[model samples]
Structures are given as structure tokens and as C-alpha cells.
Target: MSYDPSGNAFDFHGSSYVALTPNLRKLGGEVEWDNATKSATVTLNGKTATVRMAEESVTVDGVQQPLSGPSLVKDDVLYVPASFFRDVFGQSI
Candidate 1:
């Protein structure tokens, strides 16, 4: 099946881990996943946020931390909490 951004877009059917992709580049969002740390870094407008896999939470600029829900991974891509873009980056999906 083709990946649909509108349906099951938020990877809610598996582990809490989610992957981000370049398709979201239009939102001016950048995601960096560190294999060693198993942490995902999200950057927007020069501001950066780090989310630790073990914690299943995100910290923005060392403050304003938020807990994330379930995440999905398919085809080596990570699908994270959809609200991440809006709540963290201030971007309207």
C-alpha cells in the first residue's frame, strides 16, 4: 500500500519510535537521528529540539519538554507524532 499522509499518517500501530522524512522538508523541518544515541533531533528556523528514544519525550532548547504518543516505522522511515510539527515547530500541518 502507498503511504498516505492523511490516513494512519501518524504511525500509531507499533512501537513508540517514529521516523521523519524529507517529504516534511516543505515545512522547513529538519530531523537528525543519531544511531549511537538513539535520539532524534528536530530543527526548525534555526531552533533545535532533541527527543530521546528511551525517554519517549522531547526537549525544546533544553526546556519545554513534551511526551509523545505512539510512533510508526516502515521502509526504514520513521513516522512520529503528527502534532510534533505544530506543537514544537509552530508549523500548521
Candidate 2:
């Protein structure tokens, strides 16, 4: 894994993914972890999204969408597909 000011980035299946927290923070979003469920809840602009590890789908604002790949948790850090920045959060990556 490699970290930039943006966040930790790594290659998975030839695509790049990034650590979720820093980018979410940068977007002014709040992230809450649910260790019991192995998931994270992200809220931004009154919208909430739930992402879980080893899952190919996520729920955004109570709606489910196909995730590009499974989310991953490593050493307490959450890594999400980079497309998540643009596709789900409406942030330019």
C-alpha cells in the first residue's frame, strides 16, 4: 500500500483503491465503524452509505448499488474502490 496526502492507495485486480477515511474526511463526511458488523457508515450532506468488507455491493442513502469490488479492512483501516469517490460520493478523484 502507498499513501499520498489523499490517502492510502493500492492495486487490486489491476485497479486502484484507496483508504476510505481520509478521503471521506476531505469530503466533509462522517464515518462510523461497526465492528460487530464489519461495516462502515458514511454520512455526507444528509446522505448515508454503508460499506462492508468482502461484499460486492453497498447501500447509499438506503439504496443499494453494485460495488466495483469488495471493500477491505486492513489493520483497522478501510480501503474502498477508488471509483467510490466519484460514483457514490460525487467527488472528483
Candidate 3:
């Protein structure tokens, strides 16, 4: 599904999916993509989540959890599900 980012929520790709950089960074979360692993490491506060773009699950601090959908990268922006914030970072989303 496509995302929409607006205010505290989300809007789709022009404004962008979860709008990664702007919103996530504001939340004190950082994401780093690894081309070799095809996965991203997301750190928020002291929590760490590993999202593989081709997989529908995330590993948080060594714990594996299912995600609403797989993460994605398009036009160089990372698009993770809103549920990611809730499940991984303990944010309400």
C-alpha cells in the first residue's frame, strides 16, 4: 500500500511515504541502508530495527517481528509502514 504523510500522520510519495527523512529524523530516528545486505538499520532513541526491503519483517534489537509490509526504497527515499513506528520505535503512529 502507498503511504501519505501529513502533520503527524503520513502522505504518499511526492510529499512521500512516511516521508522518511523529514519526519523520522524529527523523531530522533536514523536509517542507514546497506546495499550489500539490502536492508536498512533504523535506530530510534535506543531502539534498533533492521528492515530488509525484500522482506515483510523487522528485527528490533535482535527480536524479529512481522511488519504490515516489506520496506521499500524508491527514488532514493525509504518507505517504511506507519506500523513500523508503533511496533519498532514504540511510537503511536
Candidate 4:
């Protein structure tokens, strides 16, 4: 949130969490899961992002960074924090 000089405040809202596969598909990216590691590999434009469940971080092209929130798997589907799609895909999901 932010406020202008006139004391008018601005607020923005978006999903803090996002389901992986469908969201990635929107960006023309491919996602693959690994049951053993409880992680998913996201491929987009030759770049790979590894999203691990239960962790608050993602490894993109070998570089790991903290996520906006922790990730988790629900009903066998991987749900990631919105930050990954926003920051990595360079667009809103």
C-alpha cells in the first residue's frame, strides 16, 4: 500500500498463492514434478526454476532466492507462492 501527497492511499490485491501447472501454462512454460523430492521443475524460455514444497524459496537457473511465502502441495497438485510466477515469468498470473 502507498499514499500520495494528498493523503489518498492506494491498495492493490492479488492472489498470494497460485497453482503451478495451470499458471505456468499461461506463460507458455512447462512444469514437471518429482515425487521423491517433492519439487517441481519449471521451464520457460530455456530457463529452469525449481520449486520445492514446504520451502520458502525457488531455484531458478541454478540461482536460489527466497519466495514471498512458503510453498505446499495439495491433493497431489503443487501450489506455489505468486512471487515465482511474477518474478520469473515477468508477468502477473
Per-model CA lDDT versus the true structure: 0.62, 0.83, 0.68, 0.72
TM-scores, all models, native as reference: 0.66, 0.87, 0.73, 0.77
Better of 1 and 4 by TM-score: 4
Pick by TM-score: which candidate is best?
A: 2
Q: How accurate is candidate 3 locally (lDDT)?
A: 0.68
How does residue 33 of candidate 4 score in lDDT?
85
Q: Is candidate 1 or candidate 3 better by lDDT?
A: 3
Ranking by lDDT: 2, 4, 3, 1
Tens-digit lDDT track of model 2 for 55-91: 8888998899987888976666888889987888788
- The per-candidate count of clashes, in order, stands at 2, 0, 5, 0
The window of 10 residues in a row where model 3 has the poorest summed lDDT is 7-16
lDDT of 4 by residue, 1-93 (tens): 222233222222433566778878878989888889888998987889999888988998999888876775556566676667777767676
Model 3: residue 88 alpha-carbon error in angstroms? 0.9
Taking the tens digit of each residue's C-alpha lDDT, what string does model 1 give over 1-93? Answer: 236554345434442322455635766677778989767787887778886654546788888566566334565565667676666777755
> Using lDDT as the measure, which candidate wins?
2
Candidate 1, position 28, lDDT: 68
Encode model 3's per-residue lDDT on 1-93: one tens digit a residue: 343334333443333236445566878788787989877787897988887875778898999999776666665566676767877777754
The better-scoring model by lDDT among 1 and 2 is 2
